[model samples]
Target: MRIGELARRCNVSTRALRYYEEQQLLTPGRHPNGYRDYPESAVETVRRIRTLLDAGFNADTIRIVLPCLNGDDVDMCPQVAAAIRDTLHGIDEQLRDLETKRGRITALLAGRQL
Candidate 1:
């Protein structure tokens, strides 16, 4: 299908699709007119990509896990395992940082009079 159809099916903007392409997350073919022609699988692929994005996984991590995404149970290869472990570690650090920041913000708010 065309870019517009793929975008509509995924409920994502054309620009997002372009960004996905740039991120190497989605690959579309080009028509003779130079317009993008995405395969039907692109719809599901975009959805999977979006799901990973929503989960706070970066594009790079998504790319790493792409192969395992199709399966219900992730039996990761060493490479995929490392990628996921690294992502989890990163998220842990981020959560700790956010918790600290939240505490500081809350203290500041509490010490101030409206």
Candidate 2:
């Protein structure tokens, strides 16, 4: 299929598909007419990319993890495991910071000067 068909099937914009290609995540071949020709499997690959991006995985991380993905499960190599652990830790730290800010705001709203 072509780029437009891939975008339509994946429900993502052509720009996004191009971005994915630029990120080296999606590899579509070039036609003689200079159009991009994507394999049929690109549909599912795009879906997986979206899912990983939604899960807060960056393009680089997704690139590393893509080949390790098997259906709904990730193969969880050492590097991937470490990356996930780091992401989880970062998220935890952000949650703690947000909780602290929430408490401060609540106190201020309640007229407590602290």
Best by lDDT: 2
Q: Against the correct fold, how does model 2 do in TM-score?
A: 0.91
Give the C-alpha lDDT of model 1: 0.88
Encode model 1's per-residue lDDT on 1-114: one tens digit a residue: 998899888899999999999999999999899999898899889988898889878999988898687555665889889998888899999999999888888888899532
**For model 1, how many clashes?**
0
Query: Candidate 2: global Cα-lDDT?
Result: 0.92
Q: TM-score per candidate, in order?
A: 0.88, 0.91
Model 2: per-residue lDDT, tens digit, 21-63?
A: 9999999999999999999999999999999899888898889
Residue pairs of candidate 2 with colliding backbone atoms: none
Number of clashes in every candidate structure? Answer: 0, 0
